[model samples]
Target chain A: MPERVARRTWPVHAVLVVGALVMVAPLVWEFLTSVKSFGESVRVPPTILPGTWDWSNYTKVFHSIPFGEQLLNTVLMTAGRTAGQLLLCSMAAYAFARLAFPGRDVIFMLFLSVLMVPSQLFLIPQYQIMQELGWLNSLQALIVPGVFSAFGTFLLRQFFLSLPKDLEEAAGLDGANPLRIYWHIMLPLARPGLVALGILTVLWSWNDLMWPLVVNNDPEQMTLSAGLATLKGEHFTDYPVLMAGSLLATLPVIVVFIVMQRRVLEGIAFTGSKG
Target chain B: MSNRWWKVLAAATVVVSAAACGGGGSGSDGGPVTLTYAIWDKDQQPAMEKIAQEYTKAHPNVTVKVQLTANKEYWTKLQTAVTGGSAPDVFWMNGPRIGLYAAQGVLQPLDEQISAAGADTAAYPKSLVDLYTFEGKKYGLPKDYDTIGLWYNKTLFDAAGVKHPDATWTWDDLKAAAAKLTDPAKGQYGIAAPADSQANYYNTIFQAGGTVISDDGKKSGFGDPATIEGLKFWVDLIKAGSSPTVQQMSDTEPTQLFSSGKVAMYYGGSWEANGFAKNADLTGKVDVAPLPKGKKQAVVIHGLANVAYAKSKNPEEAADFAVFASGKQAQRIQAEAGAVISAYQGTQDTWVKAHPQFNLQAFIDQVPNSVPLPRSKNTSAWTKHAEDLLLKAWTGEKDVADAAKELAKAVDEELGKEK
Candidate 1:
């Protein structure tokens, strides 16, 4: 049995290695291009390696925009969205899952209906709401609309429904309120679900381009994704500078993934099974 | 739960009312007014900032804050901002979009402001002036103009023992030079004739004595025999092995091919002057000349314009600043910075002198015969169809005449909707 398993592992490892290379090649090429000169970068049948190591491309990114401020804005936006979604979605999910209420199923259906509609349909109305609130070009404009996601509520509701009901009933018999049961019993048990949601939110917010570009116009107020976009010119873009900016912007995300990859993978696997 | 919901609703109403009240009472007279001027090109930001500073120096109470967005996202953000009633006080407008915006009444007409300031519109190119006029009202002030030219590789010409492109070159002369300059074994082409409308075919179409859209703006002119002849110019180059295949050109853009020294000549715009000058490989090897003539000496002229938003809080100030930014002094400042070819006539002399290696005057000389870029209320709608149909002709998948006729029918249908 051990020999048969060992024979099967070789082909699987071969396929996995090929898949890993295919995914990693573009990032490697981007790094290589970032170090190349403008002439070398655009050469037909492109050269694989830089002729000279030019570190100035990194410095040029800083000169082009306020990279430090953009990094801070991206971090803050992600944190705010993640925290707001976790608290709000969990509470709404608990209400729909445990507490008995009139029209509970209908309210849950209304929340799920939002997930059915495309996000593009919401852009104009959301812009008007932000304009009315006088939040255009502000960090709150980037954070507030993104905080209340119907998808997150749906995901957490599925998670809450899967938990055993015996503990909740025992807590009720002890005279504990629904909110207390939710905070003490349900949330601790839903750690894997919360982590999965948190990871997904971080990935989405970190890579989001359209909403940040639409809401914020000021360089100082823009997130990294929006700031990096300004490096592209109308007629012709300097590819080296753009690639360099993209590398710096993605470094933090890559670092976090590498450090906590096991937890992220487990969370994803757990969500996949439960879902 | 019911009480909490009510409390939340009340809080939201109070917040909304407070915001509404706070936004209404600002931008009154005698108070400091900051007018936002939005632009797209990061390369030209310093020059724009300098213009803003000069305007602010003259008007102490009025400050112009410049905002920069990437070109790809500029129109998208502008559309959203306009719909949300938060567009910039003044923003950059282009010829293709001016008709749509002006027709929609989002752009402020500058006729009254021009007369009040006594600014001379004739100082700018007449074609550019006509471009921004809608229903006999001027909606934009021409900021900078760009005309197409033949940018040649001097090194390639020298190596091939061919004389450089000159003011007197014709269609046959360009073809002959291209054949001599091409060396396929080295993976080199003489020129890169991609399916780029503004830089390539549009100029040739006019040079061949054809129009894209009629003066009435109600019909398509792509079916004209002369326009087909104009398009055939590039196709013939590819057939003669002097230019890359359309697929190859699409894979590696003509700009990249030209900049990397793989192409001997390219039909490019005057706006590329700054970019080519900064390129390490192109700086010494490149120069410009008049676009080789066909049946007529014609080039397509397009430009940027500064237009005030009709819904701007400070409409008067925004219109005045828009005029001031495109005036002779500001244009000269822009020219001196090599940001663009200023639209103000005679100020181009400084621009010509800014970079002496290239014959920049070739672009200015074409202005006399320059045709305004063909546009209508719905230019993008027809132009997108034109691009699709032209690509088929360019790739040789369809006959040029057949493609041209099909494109004309589609464009006519789109134009019919505008009425």
Candidate 2:
């Protein structure tokens, strides 16, 4: 039995190894190219290793733009969006899922309809609103618009609906109000859903390129993604510098994933299993 | 439940009112003025900042903040800002889109400001100045101009025992040298004839005495025999194994191929100087020559210009700064920094001298015979058609003439909608 199991698993392991290598190859290439000389970086039949590891490329990334400030902006923007979504989305989702409100279904459907429209459809109008609010080139511009997500509300609403009514009814008999029940009873039981939503929001906010690029222009005011974009040139780009900047910009996210990878996986799995 | 709905309505009302009342705090009277100067190239940001500092020094109360956006996103952001009525007070404008912006009343006309400052329009290249003029009114002041040249690797030339290209070299000379320089065993090509319009074919088309667009900007020149012949020059090189296949060129850009010494020659722009100068391997080995002559001596020239937003709060200040940023002093600073070839006529000498190793003067010398980059009110619409159909021809999937005819029809249709 053991021999048969080992024989069957070898092929599966081999295929998995190949798939993993394919996924990792580009990232490995990016790191290698970041340390290569400008000439070696673009060498035909491209070189796998650099003759000399140019450490200065990393330093050049810092000098070219305010990497430190942009990183901080990215962190703050992500945190703000995640916090705002968790509080606002949970409240709205609870009201939709449990409360007996007039036109409740219609309002919820109206909110869900936003998910059908493309994000780009809102760009012009949102930009105009941001301009009117004098928020262009501000950190608030990056955080505020991203905070309210209809998808988050929808996800949490489904999670809330799945919860047993006995806990809420017991809390109600104990003289707990809807807000108190949501905060103390329902939210604790809905931990997996909240974690899933929070993780998704963080990832989306972290990697968002177009919105940040459009909203902010100053290097100091920009997020890491937008700041890294400035390294590209119109006609010619220095691939080494760009790669180095990108590696540095994505390092924090990679580190976060490494530390909280199990939670991220569980959250993703929870969503997938439910779907 | 009703209370919750009322709370949501109240929050919505607050957001809407805030948006409606939130005025962008710019262009106030008498206090210190901070003007945003939006640019695309981070490579030239230092020189731009220096120019801004100088402007602020002269006008102490006015502060110019230089905002750098990447080239790919710059236009999209600009379009959004313009439509939203909140564009930067002053921003960089390119040739092809100037007409569109001016027609849409997004860019303020610079004619009155130019006259008031006594700025010599003749100081800049005539082609550039004419390129920015829309409906007989100038809307932009030329900042920096770039022209194409034949950049070659001297080590490869020496290895192949081929003589170096010079000013007097002709089309046949280039072809012969390409044939000699190509080495299939080494996986090296003599040249990279990518289907890039600006660096490769457009100059050749003009040199062959064909115009990309009619003077009236109402017709496409791709259908013309001379234009097809010019395009075929690259195609023939590809066929002869002297240039990379279209697929190869696309996979790895021609610029990368040339920089890595995989290709011996590249028809590139003046903007490549900074990138090449920074590369350690190609430092002494690379130099540029005037593009080899075809039926005539011609190269394509284009430049950026500084234009004020039409709805800027401080219109006068924005217009003045726009003109100042493109004036002789700023151009000199830009040239000395080796950022670009200044559009001002007399400032190019400094730019040529900035890079002594390469013969950068070949670009300046071609100014007399240089044709302005072909543009219309909607250049991108037609340019997109050219790219798609020309790719088919370059890939050998379709005949060049057939592709050119289809491209011409599409371009003509786009142009016909311009007015």
Candidate 3:
């Protein structure tokens, strides 16, 4: 019986190992390509391992743009956006979850429809609004547009509805107001929801390029992803330099992912909820 | 209390945000007045920074921030920036986009400033200067001009026992050389005959006595026999195996191949000579000559221009910088560096000597036959469509003649919509 079970599990282990390797191979290849000289990178049949690594590629990334500043700008903007969405969306979600109001569903529907509509349709009009606000080339422009996320509100609301009512009722009986119950009782139960929302929001904000490129032109104002765009032009050569720049720009986000892997994986696990 | 929420949010947002969107510079306790100087070229960043430093030399009161956006996004971003009132005080403008921006009344016309500076428009090639004009007013000043030519690897010619390209070479002569020099066993090819635009195919269309669009910017003439003939020269090379397969050449840039000494001939812009010279492999080996003749010897003269934003608070300062940028002092610096053939006419000789090994004079000599690069009210939209269709032909998915007609029809339809 033990031998038969072992035979069955071995194939599954092999399959998972193969899958993991396939997923990681591109990153390994990108790192390897970043260090190769431009000429060697494109030679026929391609090199699996670079014979020599060029350290100048790291220096070249800084020359390409203000890499250190861009990384910091991206981090600050991303953290602010993620935290803002988590707070604001939870408030909106609470209003919808436990409170009663007329036309609530209709307002929720309107917000929800934004997620369905293609983002390109909103870009032009939103840009005009930013112009009017005189917030162009500002981090506020990157952070403001997606602050009150419908997806976050909807996700948090579902989580709120799914929570047990006993604690909130007990808190209410203890003479705590609804706001106090919400802060002290319901919010603690919504930890997983906030974690999920925060992870998605941060990833979205960090990787976003198009809107940032539209709003922010100065290197100091640009996020890492948008700043990486300067490496490409009407005519783009120097693919190694480009790849090196890209890898360097992406490293911070990758580091974030590593530090938050457990929560990120859990967030990804629940991504099918909207379906 | 409800109305006060907006004020509260505004204050909170201001407090939370790290990136400032301040418009004006410091006064007493305040920050300096900010000015955005935008451009689209990353290759020219060092030069732009030097120029920005020069501008800051005269005006320490204003801080000129250098901004860059990539090609398609530059225009898209500029459109947004202008509409948003956050456009750069000074920004780079391509020839075709000049009309679109000017028509929208977003660009600050520099006609008065040009005259004030006593700058001679005659010093610029007329074809290029004409692009910056709208309703007898010029919106841009030429910063540089790049003319395309036949760039060949001399070591490859020597190895293949072929004569060097000269003014005397004709279309038939080019074919003979390509045929002899091509050696398939070694991954060596004779020509980089990829069907392309701006750099590759446009030259042939002009050489064959065919115009891309009419002088009045009406219908596309790509369906003309001469234009089709010009395109066929490329198709024929691939069919004869003188050029690499489209698959083999797709991701590999031709200039790279020439500099690597992998290809015998490459048609490239004079702007690329610096890039070629920088490559250690081809330093003394690569050379330039006049493009092979079809009906008449013609080349395309193209460049970028710097323009000022109309929304700028310091319009006079911005205008002064734009005009000063196109002046001979700046032009001379650009010329001696060999980064570009500066728009100032007399400064080109210095540019030629900068790359001593290459026959750099050939590019300068072709200047007279050079015409304005094809431009329209919305050129990229039409040009991009043509590229996608031609790419189909290039991969041998569509017949060249059939694709040519389809391209011409699309251009005609696009032009009609513009009308």
Candidate 4:
């Protein structure tokens, strides 16, 4: 019986291993390329291993732009957006899921409608709003627009709807106000939902490229993604330096994901299983 | 719930009102003036700042801020800023979009300023100056120019026992050299014949005595037999096993392939000299000659120009800065920095001297016989269609004649829309 089970699982393990390798290849290539000299990076039948692990590419990335400031901006932008989305989206989702009012369904539908339109359609209008606020080249311009996302509210709303209502009713009998119940009861129950939304928002905000580039021009005001973009020239690009910057920019996010891997997976699975 | 909604509305209203009132901080007065100059190249940003500082030094009250966006997204950002009515006071403009921007009335005309300053427009190449003019109004001052040349690998030529390319080499000499240099065992190709219009086909089209766009810019010239022959020049090389297949060139760009020593020859632009000079591997191995003669001796000339915004608050200062940035002294600064080949006449000597290893004069020598890069009121509208259709011919999936005719028809339709 053990032999049969092992035989049955070997193919699954093989497939899983192949899938993991496919996903990891580009990242491995990026690291290898980042450490290679410019000449070796572009050589045909590209060398699998570098002749010399040149670390100047990292120094070049710093010299080309204000790397430390941009990294700080990216962290601030990510943290602000994540925190804002969690609080606002949870509150709105709770109200939509539990409270009844005039045009409640209509407003909920209106919120969901925003998800249908492409994000690019908002670029020009958002730029105009930022210009009016004199927020161009500012951190608020990157954070504020991203704080309120429709997808986040919708996902949390489903989680709220899936929760049992008996606990809320018992709290009501104890004279707990709606906001009080949300804070003391629903908020703790919705921990997994909030974690999921926070993770997604963090990923999106960290990698957001276009809006930041369009609104901000000052090097010190820029984020890592936008700052790294300046390294790319029209006709020629130094791939080694670009790869080095990208690897540096993405390393933090990778570390964060690894640290929160179990929580992220559990949160996603909880949402999927329930709703 | 209702209270929450009201609170959100109140907060939004406060934010909007605050923004509206605070947006007027940059109002023009008899105070220190700041002019924002937008550009796309990070490598050239330092030289641009130096130029800006020169202008600022002359006018103590004025300060210039240099803004950079990468080339890939520069247009999108500029368009968004333009729509928001907050574009940079002065910015770089290129050939393809010059007509589109000028026609839309976004570009401030520089003719009056040029005449008022008695600036000799003759100081820059006439073709480049003509390029930035729309409806007989000059919208920008010529900044720099590039012409195509035959860049070859010296080590490959010596190894293959072939003479190096020079002024007298013609189409036959190039073909013979390409065949001699190619060695299949080493996975080496003689030349990179990618369907790059600026570097590869445009020069050949003109050399074959065929125009891409007519003198009046009303039609496509792909239907002409001479143009087809010009295209066949590269296709024959690929078919003869002397050049990389289109698929291979696409995987690794022709420029990169040549730089990596996989290809022996590349028809690259003068702008490539800086990059080639910087690459450690290609050092002492690469040099350039004037493009091999086809039906006639010709190359394609193209450049960028600096233009002022039409809605600039300080229009006079903006125009003055634009002209000053394109002056001979500023061009000299750009040349000495090795940023680009300055468009100003006689300043190119500095650029040529900046890189003495390669024969950059090969680029300058073709200036008199150069044809302006083909552009119309909306060049990209047709160029996009041309690229897609020409890929069929490049891959040998379709015959060159059939592809060109299809391309000509598509380009004509796009050009027709410009009317």
Candidate 5:
């Protein structure tokens, strides 16, 4: 068995290394292209690396609009969405897991149905809701519609339900209220799930284009992704600068992913087996 | 790590709550004078800002705030905002949605405003000015007008030994030349037969003397023999290796094909002239030709109009700005900069001078033969259905005759619902 495991390990490592390189190709190209001068990037047959590095693309991003403020806006929006979703999803999950409620299955199923519907169908009605709330062209317009996600609720619910009830029963006997039990015992236990959810939320919210582009037309409130689109006019192609802007926009997420790599992996591993 | 997460979470909550509480900053003006001016292009933001400043210069109390959004998103957002009573006071109106938005009463009737402003309606092209007129009331001022023309790469034509496109050229002459020039194996194409309607087929359809929509705008013209013939030219061109596949062409707009020197000639819009003029490789190597003849010479005429949003708190200020924006001074600023083909007569020469090379005058001449884009109550919703069905036809998913019949039925259904 040990010899078979040894024999399999080499191919697995080789496969993983190859898979890892494939995943990083776009990032590598984006970084290399970002460093290239606009003239070099558009050349025929395309250079693998820039002959001369130009940092002006990053500076141009700032010059084009109030990019710094927009960056701050995107960060705030992503963070707001992540925290709100984690708290709301976990709380709802705990309720469905521990507490008995009337028509709970029916309500949960209704929320799950939202996941199956095409997002485009909800766009018009969602825009109407934002306008009614007087949040059009505001940060709330970007953050609020996404705050309560059906996917997050459904996902976290499964995690909550699968947790051993004995652990919570012991906490309950210690005179912990349901809320206290949720905060101290349940949430810490669900840390890996919460981290996984948070990372996913940040990534989705940061890369989101359609809704933010629709809701926040005001330059002041526009997110990084939408703001990056205006870099090209109807003509006058500038591939290098566009690549640079894209890399800058993605930097924060890449940083977050790197920091939370362990927890995210553990969460994935746990979910794979349990699922 | 946990502390970091908590800190980030706390910081984010504070920012979102702060923004939510900002209360739109409540336009410093003490009175009820708030105006919203919607624009589809953020590229023109500076120009609009200047117009707003001039308006505010005269009327100290009126403040005009610019609301700019991308094209498709703007209309979708506008529909919802209008329904919810938060539509901008003054917005950019296009021919397609004018009737729908107006019929829904989401837009204020500009009949009084037009007469009040004493705007010279005669200075605008008759066909274009008439596009915004329904039931004898003007809904918008023609901000800028463009016509479809042939933009060609002189270097490619020279290499292919094809002569320049001229006023006397016919459709058959173009096909023979394009076919001879195209070499698909070499990644080269002769003409870009894009499936774009306004710039590509609309001219051909109009030239063939077939209207896209019926007289009452209640039926589809796709079943018309001339319309189907017009559609076939594009598909036939793709099959003959005279053009790229619809999928390949759609990946890159045809103008990019011309810029990359892969295509010899492009049937592009006059609006693209400014963008093309700025391309260094294309600067001296490009030129224009009049739309080749079919049954008669025809070109698609498109323009944007300044519209007033009904939900605006300050309608008067918004109207004043709209009128001023379409006035001679602003029009000349855009024309002289060669940014657009100004709608106002006599000021068009400045646009010609904006780009010294190429026959900009060709556009000016074709303006008389231009036909306005077809419109109904809800132009976009109806137009998009035809666009998608037609795209499928281009991709060989459906036969041309069958696709035309389907498009005709679908367009008829949408037009029927409009009634």
Candidate 6:
């Protein structure tokens, strides 16, 4: 029986290899183009490999914009937003799932309704609020509005509902209050949901383009994505320099993903089946 | 508990509305001022910064901050900021948007400022000055100008044994040369005929003695017989197998194909000279000439202008900077940078001398017979609709005459609703 199963596995392995190549082709192309001259990059019947590996494009990216300052802004903004969402979303999800409040059902329904509207509808109104608070072109404007999100709350709520009620009931019978029960019993078991939310929030905050571009005007107060966008021109764009800047910007995110690959896959798969 | 939730929501709404009404005005006219200058070109940032420095040298109490945004998102960002009443002090404006912004009351008229400074408005081209004037008020001062020309690959022309395009070349002469230059075995076509307005069809329509819109900006000229003849010039080339198919041109940019040596002739603007000069593959292999004439000789001329905001905190300084930026001294500085042709009367010779490899004078020679870019109060509303309808005729899905008539009626309806 083992030999028969092994004989049929070759074709499946071949198909998987092809799918993997399709996913990795664009990254490989971007790296290749980053090292090429501008003329060779746009040549018809494009060359697969660079004839000359030029490194000046990387240095040009730094001279054109303040890459170091923008990278630091991006990191701080992502960390603040990710940490805020994890703590706030877990508490709100715990309340909606376990507590019996006066308007629990209606309030939860209202939270779900926010997920249906497009995010662009809130841009002007949010800008006005930031202006009123004198927070325009500041890091708080990028972080404060993004801290509260409906999707994160909804995802955490589903995970909380799947937890057994007996554990919380036993804690309640032990003379523990509702806050203590939530802190000691419920959160520890919802580890996968928290990890999943943290990963999604980090990815979204790192690559958010339109908001940063609109709210901030100073180069010192921008993110990596918005700073890299300034490399594009009105009539002509230097593709090699643009690709080089983007590749440099993407390295840290790729490294973080690689370090958390196992837990990320498990956390995502676990939520997929449970929800 | 439900009553308490309602009370909290009501209190939040009241706080938000009150805060919105409180933050309207900013800064007062006093000791020192820093005006924000917004532009969209990355390549020209250094020249812009130098100009800002020059302005600061003349006026010690004011400092100008140069802000750069890519062209793709500049309009969207400007509109949102303007709606929130936090727009920049002075910014770059174009011909297509002057009417819209002026009509919306966001742009400040520079007529009073220009005369007070003793600057000569006649130093710039009449066409560009006329382009920025809307409803008898000047909203922008012309900064630079560009015209379209016929750029062809000299290597292909030398190999095909055909004469290069010159001023005497007529429409028949262009057709004959195109037929001789096409080589199927080399996977090469003679020209590219994309449905582009500025570079391809707009020049031909004017050359064929037709207008895009009436001078009064009240009607569409697409229904005229001469305009249909202009449209047929490109459709005929595609049908004759001398140009690439519409599908092929859409897959890859026509400009890219021309630079790659797959097409012999391309209709491009004066801006193309800067890019082609930098391209290594196109070095010493391309040159430009005046566009071929049909019933008349004409080309579409357009440029960018500097405009001041109406509600700025320091309106006097902003208007002063706008006028100073368009003067001959600043225009000379821009021309010496070799990026654009300055609109000042005597400053164009430096731009022409900047690129010696190509015949850059062809762009300057046709300025006398140039037409200002066709614009209305809201040009974008109908421009997109016209491009979509013209594609059907270019792709051979419908007759050119029928498409033109349908497009004319639709554009007229859009113009009627503009006011």
Give the per-residue lDDT of model 4 (tens digit) for B1-419. Answer: 44664565465445433432212234454567788899998778888999999998988777888988899999999999999988889999999999999999899999999998788998888999999988899999999999999999999999999999999999999999999989999988899998889999989998898878888888999989999999889899999999989889878888888988889999999988888877888889999999999889999999999999999888888898999899988899999877589999999999999999999999999999999999999999999988998889989999999999999998888888896
TM-score of 3: 0.91
The lDDT per prediction is 0.88, 0.89, 0.80, 0.89, 0.78, 0.87
> What TM-score results for chain B when candidate 6 is compared with the true chain B?
0.92
- DockQ top scorer: 3
lDDT by residue for model 3 (B1-419), tens: 32453464565566466456645553421234556778777766667777777767766765677777877678777776676676788888888778788888888999889999899999998888898888788888998899888999888899999999899888889999999889888788899888777667788888888888888888898898888887877888888888887887877766666666667888888888776765555657788899998888988888878788887877876777787777787777777777788898798888898889888899889989997889888887789878888888887899989999999999988887774
Cα lDDT tens digits, model 5, B164-234, are 88999998988988998898677889899877899888889888887789978888999888998888878
For each candidate in turn, the interface RMSD (Å) is 5.5, 5.6, 4.5, 5.0, 3.8, 7.2
Q: lDDT of candidate 1?
A: 0.88
TM-score of chain A of each: 0.96, 0.96, 0.94, 0.96, 0.90, 0.96
Superposed on the true chain A, the predicted chain A of model 4 yields a TM-score of 0.96
lDDT of 1 at B270: 90
TM-score of each: 0.94, 0.95, 0.91, 0.94, 0.89, 0.94
Error of 5 at B71 (Å): 2.2
**For model 2, how does the per-residue alpha-carbon lDDT over B1-419 read when each residue is reduced to its tens digit?**
44654464466445434432223356456678888899999779889999999999999878898988889999889889888887899999999898889999998888899999999999999989999888898889999999999999999999999999999999999999999999999988999999999999999899888778999999899999999988889899999999999989889989889988889999999999988887788978999999999999999999999999989888988999999999999999999988689998799999999889999999999999999999999889999998999999998999998999899999999999988
Clash count in backbone of candidate 3: 8
Over A1-275, each residue of candidate 6 has an lDDT whose tens digit, in order, gives: 59989889989989999999998999999999999988888887789999899889999999988999899879877876777787789889999998999999999999999999999988898888987788777777777787898889989999999999999889888999998787778877888888888888888999998898888887877899999888888877888999999999999989997999987788668656322
**Residue lDDT tens for model 2, A1-275:** 69999999999999999999998998999999999988888777788989999989999999988999999889878877887787789899999999998999999999999999999989899999988877887777888898899999999999999999999999999999998898789888888898899899998999888888888767887899898888887755778889999998778888988998988898889777321
Note the clash tally of each candidate. Answer: 0, 0, 8, 0, 1, 0
Per-prediction DockQ comes to: 0.39, 0.39, 0.47, 0.40, 0.37, 0.30
As for TM-score, the candidate ahead, 3 or 5, is 3
Chain A of model 6, TM-score against the native?
A: 0.96
Error of 5 at B190 (Å): 1.9
Q: List where candidate 3 sits over 4 angstroms from the true fold.
A: A42-45, A273-275, B1-21, B26-34, B58-63, B259-261
**In CAPRI terms, where does candidate 6 land?**
acceptable
Displacement of residue A155 (Cα, Å) in model 3 is 1.6
How does residue A158 of candidate 5 score in lDDT?
84
